[model samples]
Target chain A: MVKAAQRMYYGKALAKLAERKEIVVLDADLGGSTRTSDFAKVAPERFIQIGIAEQNMIGVASGLAAAGKTVFASTFAVFATGRCWEQIRQAVAYPKLNVKIVATHCGISVGGDGASHQALEDIAIMRALPNMIVISPADANEAYAATMAIADLKGPCYMRMGRADFPLITSEGVKFEIGKAAVLRNGNDVTLIGTGQMVMSCIEAAGILEQNGISAEVINVSTIKPLDSETILASVSKTKCVVTAEEHSIIGGLGSAVAECLSENRPTPQIRVGVKDSFGESGDPGELMKKYGLTTDDVIKAAENVIGKKGKK
Target chain B: MGGAKGLDVKDLRRRADKIRMHVIEMTSEAGSGHPGGSLSSADLFAVLYFHVLRHDPKDPEWEGRDKFVLSKGHVAPVLYAALAESGYFPVDELLTLRKIGSRLQGHPVKGKPPGVEMSTGSLGQGLSMSCGLALAAKLDKKDTRVYCLLGDGELQSGQNWEAMMLASHYDLNNLTIFIDRNHLQIMGSTEKTMSIDPLAYKLRAFGLRVISIDGHDIKKIIKACEKARSSSSPTAIILNTVKGKGVSFMENNADFHGRSCKPDEKEKALKELTERMSSW
Candidate 1:
């Protein structure tokens, strides 16, 4: 499996956007870790090192956006979303400013730094805000494309990326849109929905399910806020049962979004594969994924469980 | 810079008195608001709008206009009054404050009424925004200065300190922060609420040129803002003001910090301001 860190691709995308003078990047002393140093290397003048103050970083981004500059505020997911959630709500979302809060090192994959460093609830909180566009890119390629896409977009957006280098699932030139989901592989026996690094696990699970004569469809749900209900409904209408996967918690992230969409339109049987409303512990990234039930085998097990309930009363 | 846009100190005082009267009337009409802070900062707002700020109320989005952010946004009355008086909108619309479907929300919302620059109600956030606007102006090579007004009590939020460090780090010479040192918060005096005193020393330690002055003095306000504009780095102007200035019953009173005057109290406050206006 060819793996690439989404944060790396995000930095590359920012460096590529150096020619756009209106673009400004801000980081809160985590530039090297979050990879915004890539942008600073090229467009040193436009990149703002806002020290370790996430709340003030968001405020500065809001002011820059108000002054007609496209601002991308980058930091760890915990600080970017958790420490300054209200600042984002008041300064960015309320005004509907053109500030993209791209957070890196999301989910339990941020190992060794422990629970305090991991951000398992960012998706839920970011999704709750009005006028906020929440996205979780499936891979590094999609992260790069989404970075370019959001710069072209003019409003408040939150894009969450992972810490470890996950499998490259999407193609290099994947056309990323703000509110649309991309269907990766096609089948009929069951539907597999996933986001972030977990989407790769979903695709791998579909392959395993195919060997057992149970066909599975893979859908990468990157844009979590506007749940691309049309695409999701169309797949579930044929598949009848569903399994959702993500590196975040099962509460208000991708799992909850899919559940709400299905309950409203399709009423299909679904199993959500994510952290079970618990905090993460310090461990290897792969070990954390397995312990938290976010691995490919977990997706396969969820698929089997939901598929069993497909034909039942 | 010397006396304020050809308007003498007497004229500016009259303008401030009218703004204070509008604050009293608007808050009484809304039946709620932070009139104490609004009244305290009315003089600063008057000086900024009438004297120092380079703005066109007729063309609120004028490219060359300077930006002012009401960091302590609960004081919407003074900003609304100043904008209305400066012709951003009709003065009659000032009465619609805090009412449903009015652009004049309880707090200053950006683009709600063209003159309001940033949407600020949450404290300790506006200074960082002012830094952004100032940095952008420098990046864009515009001479536009950014000013922010904050409540002294709001300094406890910690985010303000973060912003102060950024301002000094970036050498945001185009930015000026006015700390409304009315010495009062909702609970009690700021000294008792949480000591942020030795305040000027703290600001200087944070790498700002701290200027302390009587906030109600129109000439001093104008001169301090002017000095801040030309500063080699960020400046903090400490405006020593009464909590509820001008109104004898409300001055230095914490109860009026977030309350509206009663009907008779409103009448008395209005009468006092009117008399002060007539004397000018």
Candidate 2:
């Protein structure tokens, strides 16, 4: 059975933490859509609904964090990361405050609402900021675990979540740690690195490649800012090739992160499979993913091309 | 040193004059700083650091201490001067404004200065931060109030209005907002550019108790601050001030908004404020 969206699990995590007595959740009037309303139900007094003002919401979250409250500021990814980018930089990131900006409805999976609502560049923008930790969980379970994990970690963080239901990939009690890669499936022909919703596709692509006897290693990169270079380098050094899949832009998303890591340490042949410098259009999420070159088929094809570049049997 | 019930008006005036002189010298030394806005807000800064705020200069992170957010952070020279003069740091450190590796950065950075409460440089964010702080203070059941200073130009940013609504909606009685109505921004007069005229009505409409005051008057500024503390709702004190308060050449001069005074202009400004310092 498919689980709820990552945002649903985020809200559930906060509800579970309601007894902790220090967690304060804020939303930019999009609580219902972002699923932060779940926390509002459990801890109404602790939840602050700042109406339609993303900038003020971020600043207020920073203030609460400064005053010793673990603050979670949530909204749609476009408004949370793009509209209030400067506010996040000035008030939250600069101070290195313990504020988690968990933005939902990220990427083309926020389908039919069109490009204006999709946050294809959040990873790049957030990672560029000093003292900002960017994370994109693979599924609902990881998002839930990441929410709990982020509360314990210090410093400003940007967590991106998607709109649609994600297939359950991780079993219960799978440990979640910031800046660490989870080796989902181990193999040797090529490394399949993915983040957010695309990790499911990378897993499927690895399975298909295994059927073809290509033996693709699958790694889920939940943390984007501090790219898990050690795991990617080790995997790529053994595989000698990589195919990075993400639901964001190919320009600066997980693909670019993997490429940057491999170029410095492993020097492996890499293929970046994502939205290639284009905006998403209104369509079904499945069709949009295929249109944007973020499908499992695309990752499998990228794996073949990259392995071919290695010039190995 | 700040153990007095309230600072005597004359002593506060002398301190304000000294602060104004320091603003001139520091901005002149920096060679590129906002002297006009700093000069305008010097009196209010004087009254706050010396009289109004409940802070320990030594224990800058005192939980019970009242917080101040320089919403109009370009006028950081005045805040820096007050912090130094109040012994939060060395008085001589005022001369190092905007220099490489100086704690006195071009804008008010909270951690760098012992008493600077929030980092502010980008306009229209401090009021929101103030509301957050005030809400927290109320949650902790402390009498600690938050004071945020906003510029006339900064009021144009829509985020300030958003913060205003939040403060009012939350009934953040512990927050006091001061708007420095200096009429001039770097571009030109606020009226010629984006006008914030009839600001009293706008502030009241936004659900704040508005109090108009002569910003340069130490006694009046102090009185309004007292009233803000006693108010049941969050207060917005409108400080009707000249762009450049103490200096003759710079007063109401848009040219002096962000640019530091030239050597001759700096000498003239110091000469005028130095004489007033002796009398006050």
Candidate 3:
């Protein structure tokens, strides 16, 4: 099967949801890029094109939410989270408005747009805001299900998606619950947790680890903020070591979230494989991932390193 | 629709003066609040809450009621005064302006007060939210109008301009934006700090129905509001007003923008407005 873009899945999900619910989709002049144009096509009256104004989009979404409309604000991750940080903080998060900020083209995968467009810190920024539910789907299937899940939950939510088209790891009938981690392939040597676009690589990394006599349990943590700590702790307590992978800055992405949970809860030795604390350059997505030490081999190496440190201390 | 209820200009003038008096007393009690900007927009708020706004004083959350947003949230004293006078809360509660336990927060918080529409302490955000409310009303096929009062100093934030453009672009005719052209910022004049000269032209260029009026004149404010309601585009009512409008010592004074009036200052200020009430 061909890979699907999570952003396209996001747009299709909104368009489908509009058929039943009174959904309002807002875009900051990136409807085509973010794939929200799909929603605009289906329901033009419900779609608001705000013309490159990210802050206004967020504030407007809050107002719509206050008026009892399920509002989905779409833009690139950088502008959706960073440019309109205060608006999301004061208007939406502080008020706990039922507004969904679903941003696409996250991380270095934005490719040629370079560091300016890459949103390496979006997860961290949104996660820090109170009353904000941050979710990063692993693939297009999870992205669709997650989009539907956020609509059902009333409150401020931030759903992050990548620009690249990735093959689906989760099949149909798989339950996608927020704050619940999905353990795809179970093993006992070490636990590998990944989020957003990195979970696909984690599965492949587990494949490589299996060849090396390392049995790895692959867990997909879609919801990063209200993290599935119980599921993660259960797996880590069994494996005694963990590997966290994400296509985001290593400082405050999935790795940081898992580290924060384990360092305080279980104290498991872990290896975090992600973008270093630096800006991304303009390059092909795959090339940039290899250059930034975010690949299948990187995750495999990280799993081995953590497995090696399982009983040393 | 809003009913005049046989209330003449005399009544509105008295109400405006009373609002100003409350602003002065509230700020004086708070010990650190914006009196100048509050006083400047008191007349606008008086006319809005008392006469023009289609709201039920008893039902502050009436879904059909017109929405008002104080985008220049620093001048929350006047909003509290108007809300108090309109029976949204106790008139005596105006003295608890900045008290920790009081619902009357330093800035206008939506749920904090009955009539307050939304929380807007940071400048340049209220208009966008107003536009959103107006847009939602349009989507619902309701004629609920939205009024947002902005301080000239708050226009320095770029987000206001972005909202201004979208309000015009989307043809948010249900939204009426009033810029309190008080000229004075907390530090100095708006021109000296960040020159937003050619203000009318800037708003007109954004395709709004621009109406410039004396912010202190109850009659002109009414007329401008009428013109605003009739326009097909979003209306920008530019109010030419003094920072400290009613008080003799505070008018056009930048120092009075954020400072509380001393006891002596409050006494003189109250006496000035109280004298205007006897004729009623």
Among these predictions, the greatest DockQ belongs to: 1
Candidate structures ordered by lDDT, highest first: 1, 2, 3
Range of the 10 consecutive residues with the lowest summed lDDT in candidate 3 chain B: B1-10
> Residue B269: error of model 2 in Å?
1.6
| lDDT, candidate 1, B31-105, per-residue tens | 999999999998998899988899988888889899999999999899999999988999999899999999999
lDDT of candidate 3 over A99-144, digit per residue (tens): 9999998988889989999999999889999999999999998899
TM-score chain B for all models.
Answer: 0.98, 0.98, 0.97
Query: lDDT score, residue A132, model 1?
Result: 96
Clashing residue pairs found in predicted model 1: none
Question: Which residue pairs clash within candidate 2?
Answer: none
- DockQ comparisons of all candidates to the true complex: 0.87, 0.75, 0.69
Cα lDDT for residue A165, candidate 3 = 90
Candidate 3 lDDT for residue B258: 82
Docking level for model 3 = medium
Query: Count of backbone clashes for each model?
Result: 0, 0, 0
* Residue B14 accuracy (lDDT) in model 3: 89
Error of 1 at B104 (Å): 1.0
Which candidate do you rate higher for lDDT, 1 or 3? Answer: 1
Candidate ranking (TM-score, best to worst):
1, 2, 3
Chain A TM value for model 2: 0.97
